[model samples]
Structure formats: C-alpha cells, structure tokens
Target: MSWSIRIGSIAGIRLQLHVTFLFFLAWIALSQGLLTGHAERAL
Candidate 1:
C-alpha cells in the first residue's frame, strides 16, 4: 500500500506527507489524552 501522498509542489520541489507519521502523532495524542484526561494537554 502507498504510505505517502504528494499533496503539492513548491519551486519544483514536491511536498508529501507520510501516513505512518500521522498515525504516530495520533497515537501520541490519544495516549497522552487518556493518561492526562485532558484533550488540550494532549495536543
């Protein structure tokens, strides 16, 4: 499966976002939110 997407480009340089990185961020936020019981702090 594809893991990243080329969203756009700037000055002939491609800008892409890796799906796994996003998953990692979400996991961190979710775990932190659960531990602290505060959404703001998780972010």
Candidate 2:
C-alpha cells in the first residue's frame, strides 16, 4: 500500500491510486490507441 498515493476521501473512507493501477491504465490507453490508430484517443 506504500506505493499508493492518497487521492481523496469519501464519507470518511480514503481513496488511493496504486502504482500498478496507473500502469494498467496506461496499458489500456496504449492498446486502445493502437487498435484505433488515433494517438489522441489514448488521452
């Protein structure tokens, strides 16, 4: 959990973004861009 950054809180519960989740997101975007052939689509 040390790799996660605190994002915010919701109703006393904390939210965080893990480092692996970021990489997973990047992978998704890259795959989408490759499939669509549109770099802007990755954003």
Candidate 3:
C-alpha cells in the first residue's frame, strides 16, 4: 500500500517521504538507542 503522498516540490526538485513512515523510523531509532543504554544518541 502507498502510505506516502507526493506533497510538493520546488525548482524541479522532487521530494518524497511518507510522514508517518518518517516518524515511525525516528521512533524506532530513538527507542532502540534508548533501550540499548545509549540515550545520548537517541535522537
């Protein structure tokens, strides 16, 4: 399923990324880092 929508662009450049997917990725990385006792690198 397509979870991302081509929001917009500028100067002929194309931008693509699912909002939720991006957030989900961030959450995963942060959580993993925190759980691994590396909270300083969570972001």
Score each candidate by Cα lDDT: 0.88, 0.90, 0.84
- Candidates 2 and 3, the one with greater TM-score: 2
How many residue pairs collide in each prediction? Answer: 0, 0, 0
The candidate that wins on lDDT is: 2
Looking at model 1, which ten-residue stretch has the lowest summed lDDT? 34-43
TM-scores vs. true structure, each candidate: 0.68, 0.68, 0.53
Q: For residues 1-43, what per-residue lDDT tens digits would candidate 1 score against the true structure? A: 7888889999999999999888899889989898888876776
lDDT of 2 by residue, 1-43 (tens): 3999999999999999899999999899988998999867786
- Runs in model 2 lying further than 4 Å from the true structure: 39-43
Better of 1 and 3 by lDDT: 1
Q: What's the TM for model 1?
A: 0.68
| Predicted structure 3, TM vs. truth | 0.53
Better of 1 and 2 by lDDT: 2
- For model 2 the TM-score comes to 0.68
Clashing residue pairs in candidate 1 are none
